[model samples]
Target: MYLVHTAHWQFLGLTLGFLAWILTMVTAGLNEWRLWHMDDVSVITSGVAWVGIWKVCFYTHVLPQMEFCRRISMSDSFLPVEIPVAQVLMALAVICGLAGSISGGVAMRMVYFTVEDRRNIRLVFILTGTLYLFSGSCSLVPLVWNMNSVLINSTIDFPPEYYLPVVPVRQQVGTAIGVGIFASILMFISGLMFLCYKYARHTLRSVAPRSTSNPLRGPWTTTAQRSNGVNKGSDNPAFLSEEVSC
Candidate 1:
């Protein structure tokens, strides 16, 4: 059999994990995790300035138009605690997701191809699940933290050279954070599915031996002694009626 759960859901889980990894990588590279709006200002420069773990941007699509994105340093004086924390967390998430993906792919191949013993297959599945779960956790912490900060209009003691307002009149979660949230959820679910698959396969395989271990009682056959006894009327002849040809 294809397994008790049929393995379809497990395939979906692996696909979800791969998509989450891609989104996390994109989120790590994006500068839209948080936004600061300058639309209230009465100048052509008025627009949005967004920031990420390692970079910030300032841009206006109209008059005096330009786009500027520059890397920010964790070592900068008086930087918000969130930035440095996000840098480490997002990097860790990317790394973990990558490791999980590689292991997961290899494990899938081994499973469908029957390349190893059952114990080794179980181990690989568990390892992949752990790594993906860790990746989701890493992403969720920083993304949620920054989203809360934006909700509260959190401020920092950024030095004047940084040109960031101590408190922007308007701020919101950005595209990157939204993407991270979705990716985190998908990654989390995928990890859970993989773990379930591992345990279920183990449990089901262990029980299967008990059901058909006796060749005489196998699903597709019966004991020759039983057949002979029935033929000779030593056993219940009525039972053989069921298997008799017309």
Candidate 2:
């Protein structure tokens, strides 16, 4: 009999995890975390700025937008101690996701282990599941941390007469954050499914019947025999027991 019964669940978990990793990468690469708009200001003077992990983008509020705009890199800053924390963390998360996805793929459905035995297959699933959990954690920390930073720094006080209103024009969460959240959730669920599949597979293997080709070990072919005398014949001398001989 095949050792593992629940291979379908493992495949589902790996697919979901890989998809989540892709979403996270796409979210981290974009630059639309925050936006600012002016309602009662002139189009010539009104403009908007967006925040991202890598750079800040500015655009004019005119109907026909100008071709020129400004972009400031996060690595060029000198006052904030010359370290791009958000970029580094997000890159690390991507790396971890890649590693986890590869490991999980190798462990799923016995695709990578054609020459290995059944007893050691469960270990691969457990290891890959742990890696996936770590990958999810790495992805979650940066987005949430950067979100908090944006909220704290966007607290600028300005009147309505200003061209760039800070009070009414709130800093809303970007599409990247939403996508990252969804990716994190999917990764977490995938890791949990992998772990569950491992446990369930172990349980199934334990209760299954073991196969043996040797007929001597079978219960029906045992060495013991009953002494019923049904095999003895009256004509045989060995069957003539005592005084009443035939």
Q: What total of clashing residue pairs does each candidate reach?
A: 0, 0
lDDT of 1 by residue, 1-246 (tens): 243344566677789999999999999889998888764443325467777888776753443566666678889766688888999999999999999988888777666665335567778888888999999999999999999999998876656554666777788899999999999999999898878874334333454444636666566443344464475324456777866844
Question: Which model scores highest in TM-score?
Answer: 1
In model 1, what lDDT does residue 47 have?
62
Taking all chains together, each candidate's TM-score versus the true structure is 0.74, 0.64
Model 2, position 194, has a per-residue lDDT of 77
TM-score of 2: 0.64
lDDT of 2 by residue, 145-231 (tens): 667655765543322322344443556667887788789888888888877764333333456676665766555333343358444
Report the error of model 1 at residue 113, Å: 0.6
lDDT of 1: 0.79
lDDT for each candidate structure: 0.79, 0.64
Where does candidate 2 stray beyond 4 Å? 1-4, 38-46, 61-74, 78-83, 109-116, 152-168, 199-246
